[model samples]
Target chain A: MPEPIDFYFDFSSPYSYVAANLIDALADRHIRSVTWRPILLGPVFEVSGNRPLNAQPMKGDYMRHDVPRLCRRHGIPFAWPEPFPIATVAAARAVYALWDQDAEQAIRFAKAVFRAYFANGRNIGETDGVLAVAADEGIDAAALGQAIQDPAIKARTKAAVDHAIKLKVCGAPFFLVDEEPFWGVDRLPLMDEWMARGGW
Target chain B: MPEPIDFYFDFSSPYSYVAANLIDALADRHIRSVTWRPILLGPVFEVSGNRPLNAQPMKGDYMRHDVPRLCRRHGIPFAWPEPFPIATVAAARAVYALWDQDAEQAIRFAKAVFRAYFANGRNIGETDGVLAVAADEGIDAAALGQAIQDPAIKARTKAAVDHAIKLKVCGAPFFLVDEEPFWGVDRLPLMDEWMARGGW
Candidate 1:
């Protein structure tokens, strides 16, 4: 069996939301599993002197137009979140907490969070919103609240961000297949080809 | 008949070199012609508070790895320029000069300049280097030298940059199809689809 692809993403990223919708199916086709690693872009942005996509002048405008168009092209459902680039700390911590108990459940929970934020247009930045999404995935809301605040889970989430920075992951929807880094959801085609050919 | 696609590029951008290799063929397939507009990115960068791709921290490193990988994938010849992000004023001016006289030869000259700088790893930043590439494309070296220095040609090149900025063209390989702006070479697929579907 080949190495599992490392899929790094942040909860607030629409591009990550799009990648989440596609990566699993793509990986299954290649007989590979994906390891979803939820990360926070806040610290990464601070360190890299980068701003959120919507904050950048020209790029922000382009992304706003492109995201929906891309969603339509891929046949993925999407609704733009209002007050975009919300805090993703609560979502990340919850994913880290659930991951320790059940990786599959964590993946499902993360996808739910993405849908809530990107598809349903709910604000995942709010703790209640994140918990509601998790509950929809069959995770107990009260238990998840405690786990999200657990010191260990908080550390794990921070560690994920630190790991991302160490790996030079400057963008969401970044992938590492056999340690070959590929950034952006746009690079997915190349990633698919790379996996099929086992590297070029 | 469709409006000719405006291909906005900066000679110093590797992504532009990659797009330059593919845009014409992609346009031809749609029975559309392309208007290559070589603009200087220096002023655009200054206004946008952006740096060259290689100057950004992780993104720079990723671009270095990606450009070659993409070139190989597209079957386009490429070699890393020693001192990339070189000044493209002379080349742009020469292009504008030749464009005023013979548009087809100007396109050939621009392609030659791109091939010299990106594929052959020659320094087209220098006036002599630009002249050599132009001469190789059947342009008169002496006449081209005078034209490249003509104030009108220099102003035309500057005006092109101003026009690009006005269009919110923040990156190289930007395309304007029927006044719909698309930035980055990666966006070509969408542009192709947009043209095919007559916008979505």
Candidate 2:
């Protein structure tokens, strides 16, 4: 079997939300599984000397228009979150916490968190909001609440971000197919072709 | 008739080079024409608080890998030009100079300049290099060389850049389909859909 595709994402990135929604089907087509690794963009952006998209001068404006249009194109449910690009440490830790117990459940939790923040504008940056999203996904909310604060889980999330940085991941929704990197939701088609052609 | 697509591009940008190579064929498929407006990124970067892709930290590295992959994917001829992200004012001025004499020829001049810099590794940022590329296109060498230095041609290129800034063009290969903006070569697919469906 081929190596599972490595999917790195930040919870607060809307483009990540789009990729999270679409990646499974993409993987399914190639008979590949996915390894969902949640990362925080804060540290990554600092290392890369990049700012948040919404904080950039003209790009911020372009993203504001582009995100909604992308959602409409993909038929993904979306509403721009209030106080966008929130601190996603809580959400990332929560996924790591879930991963320690159940990988499938963790994927569900990650998708739910994305939908809660981007689709419902539920601000998953806070522990309380993320817990609520976990509960809605039929997860044990109390366990997740406690797990996010667990020292081990927090370290796991930190290590994941460090790994992404080490890999030179510059943005959310970054993918690695056997160590070939592809960034952005826009790269999905290209990635699909890459997988289909077994690398060009 | 539907409105023509406005293509804003910088000659030094690799992605813009890709778009410049493909955009005409894309337009032809939809019974559309493109208006290729050459603009310099230096002023746009200043106004947008942006840096060149090759100057950015991790993004620069990503771009180096991504450009050749994209060119191979699209079957476009490409070679990374040394001294990339060069000052393109001379090339921009040359396009404008050609525009004043012949609009269609200006578009040809623009494409040839991109090919010279990206495919042939010519240093198109220099007046002599640009004039040489123009001459290869059967343009009058001395006339085109003098035209590039014309104060009016220089002002025209500057004004075009200013106009792009006024339109909030944040990057190279930005497009406007009836005033709805799309940025990047990646957006060409979306722009095609938008034009096909008459916007979403």
Among all candidates shown, the one with the greatest lDDT: 2
Tens digit of lDDT per residue, candidate 2, span B1-200?
67788999999999999999889888987888888898888999898888888988899999999999999988999999998779898988888888767889999989999999999999998889998998899999899888878898888888999999999999988999899999999888888899889888
For candidate 1, the per-residue lDDT at A24 reads 90
Tell me the TM-score of each prediction against the true structure: 0.96, 0.98
Candidates in order, interface RMSD in Å = 1.6, 0.9
Q: Cα RMSD (Å) between model 1 and the true structure?
A: 1.4
Per-candidate DockQ values are 0.57, 0.83
Deviating ranges (above 4 Å) for candidate 2: none
TM-score of chain B of each: 0.98, 0.97
Best by TM-score: 2
- lDDT (0 to 1) per candidate: 0.88, 0.90
Model 2 agreement with the true structure over A158-187: per-residue lDDT tens digits: 888998999999989899999999999998
